[model samples]
Target: MDTLMPADDLTDELRAISAVVATLEHAQQNELPDEFAGLFRHDAIWTTGGGRRLLGRDAISAFTHQVLPGAMAASTATYEVEHVVFIRPDVVAVKVRQTPVGRDGVPLPGVNPGSPTYVMAKEDGRWLLVAAQNTEVVDG
Candidate 1:
C-alpha cells in the first residue's frame, strides 16, 4: 500500500526536526542527562546502543544519569539528522548518524559510529521523542 504524505511544509518540518536532533547531540556532548532526557515524552521508550531497553522518561533518566557522565570521558559523540519521514501531520521517523570523536577532535578508531532512529510526535506545538532505537554500525 502506498503511504500518503502530509500537506505540511516539508522543509520547515525538516528544519525543526534537525534542531531537535541537534539538541540531543548537544545534551550528550555536555553530559547533561537531564537535558537529554527532557527531549523525550513523559512515557517515551528507548533502546540503547548496547540493546538495553528503557521504558519511560524516568527510566531513561535513571540509566542516563548512571552512564552518560562517563560516556564522553574518552570521546564525544555527535549526532546529525540523516533523514526525516513524516508518518502523519504530528508524527515523524527520524534517522540520525552518530560519530564518536576523540579529545583531539578526530574520529576515534576501533569504535564504530552509530545509527539511531527516533520516532517523534508533535504535541502542544512542540516535538518530543516518543520512541528511539540506537544501533552501533558494525563493519564486517
Candidate 2:
C-alpha cells in the first residue's frame, strides 16, 4: 500500500465498484440472468427482497433464470451505489439504492425502494459479490 493510502487508489477502487454496480444494473435492466448471476462468487449467499434465501451461485443462477426473464418487461430497475464501507483493502460493504422505473423514466408508484447491501471481496485481481442481502424499504 502506498504511504498516502493513495487517494488515487481509493478513487480507482470506487470506480471499479461503481462499474460492477453498473453491470448489475445493465444485467437486471436487460433481464439477462446469466450476466446477473455471473457477478457472484461460487459460494455466494443471497437473500432476496421478498425474503427468499439463496445459497451458492448455482441456486442464485436458477432463481435468476426462473424470474429474470419477463420480469423487466413491465418495469426496469436502476441500482445506485449509495455508500461503500471499506472492510479491508480487498473487501467492501456496498449499500445500493434500487428503484423501479417505467419506460418513460418515471418511478413506479407503490413499489418500495430497495436497500440492499452487497459484501464484495477481491480475489485473483477481480471483485466478486460474496454475500448480499436485499431489503425493500417500505413505509410504516
- Each candidate's lDDT (Cα)? 0.88, 0.90
Clash counts per candidate, in order, are 0, 0
| Candidate 2 lDDT by residue in tens digits, 1-140 | 33234788889888998988999999989899999999999999999988999999999999999999899877888899999888888999999999989966689988898889999998888889999999988861
lDDT for residue 67 in candidate 2, whole number 0-100: 93
Model 1 residue 11 lDDT score: 63
Q: Evaluate residue 91 in candidate 2 and report its C-alpha lDDT on the 0 to 100 scale.
A: 91
* Candidate 1 per-residue lDDT over residues 60-130, each given as its tens digit: 99999999987887789888888777788789999998988886678888889999999999899889999
Q: Which stretches in model 1 have alpha-carbon errors above 4 Å? A: 1-8
TM-score of each prediction: 0.90, 0.94
- The segments of candidate 2 whose C-alpha lies over 4 angstroms from its true place after superposition are 1-4
TM-score, cand. 1: 0.90
- The prediction achieving the highest lDDT against the true structure is 2
